[model samples]
Target: MGMSDKMVTVLRRQFEPTVEMLKNLIEVCPDDFWFDAKHKYWKQIFHATTSMKFWFRQQKDEEFIIPDFGKDVTEDLDKECSDYPTKEEMKNYVEEISSVARKFFDELTDDKLLEPCVLYEEITRTDVILMQIRHVQHHIGYCNNILNSNHLEAAKWL
Candidate 1:
């Protein structure tokens, strides 16, 4: 495989299974614990998905629309919003972002991957994708910890 092709494969391996694990987490999370402020499953998933969606797109900060409950600033921190989306709503979101990620990888080119970009730091498109994947995995690990604590099966890596 070419370099771009290999990167695409790596991205799929990173993102797809993480999202699947998240889906499993949401499906099996107990109703009582779903909205628990300490480990809100929905919010965790929201943060992961939103970050993936945002960084996956090559858009400026001004062009990005922060989600309703998302915290994008120090001032926005600790401000709670009551409108967390239902699992069903977020399932659609998961699917939508899945499609977006797929398209990004599907169309990835070596030049595009190496293109210089600035977002939170000066980096290449390749670095942005890798960073975003790591961001998603961090939340995936958190969800798995919650599952383990609740006597649920942790998601396996694909």
Candidate 2:
């Protein structure tokens, strides 16, 4: 495989399974926990999806629009939203991020990967990819901990 092709494959391997893990997390999370006013599991999911979505297209110059259910993604981010998204909306948001990520990775070129990430001249797109992956996984761990604590089934490690 060409370098771009290889990077694409590696990126997909890193991302796809994690996102799937997240999808399973969403499905397995009980409604009581997901919607809990104090616990805010849904907000955690929202932060994960929004961060992934933002990293791909909005981190530097673009704007991020929250899903129809919520207003703007404010400074408080996961919190401070008056309207909460339903479980299905959260699921669809994850699916949408997965789809967008698939396209982004599929189009990766060696030049594109080497290009400086807008975050900093020293940081390349490759760095951004790894950073985003780590960010998502951190949230996954948080969510999984919540599930395990509640005596509920959580997504297993991929």
How big is the positional error of residue 25 in model 1, measured in Å on the Cα after superposition?
1.8
Which of the numbered candidates is closest to the native, going by highest lDDT?
2
Task: Point out where model 1 deviates above 4 Å.
Answer: 1-4, 69-77, 118-121
| TM-scores for every predicted model | 0.78, 0.84
lDDT of 1 at 118: 42
lDDT of 2 by residue, 1-158 (tens): 36546776777788888888888888888888876766667777778788778767624666667665654332244356555677898888899988877766765766688888655789777887888889888888988989888899888888
lDDT tens per residue, model 1, 1-158 = 36546766766677677778777767777766766666666677778887777777745653666545242221122556554566676778778877877766776766567876446556887887787778778877888788798887776765
lDDT (0-100) at residue 137 of candidate 1?
Answer: 80
In model 2, pairs of residues that clash are: none
Candidate 1 clashing pairs, residues 3+ apart or interchain: none
- Quote the positional error of residue 72 for candidate 2 in Å: 9.3
Off by over 4 Å in 2: 1-4, 58-61, 68-78, 118-120
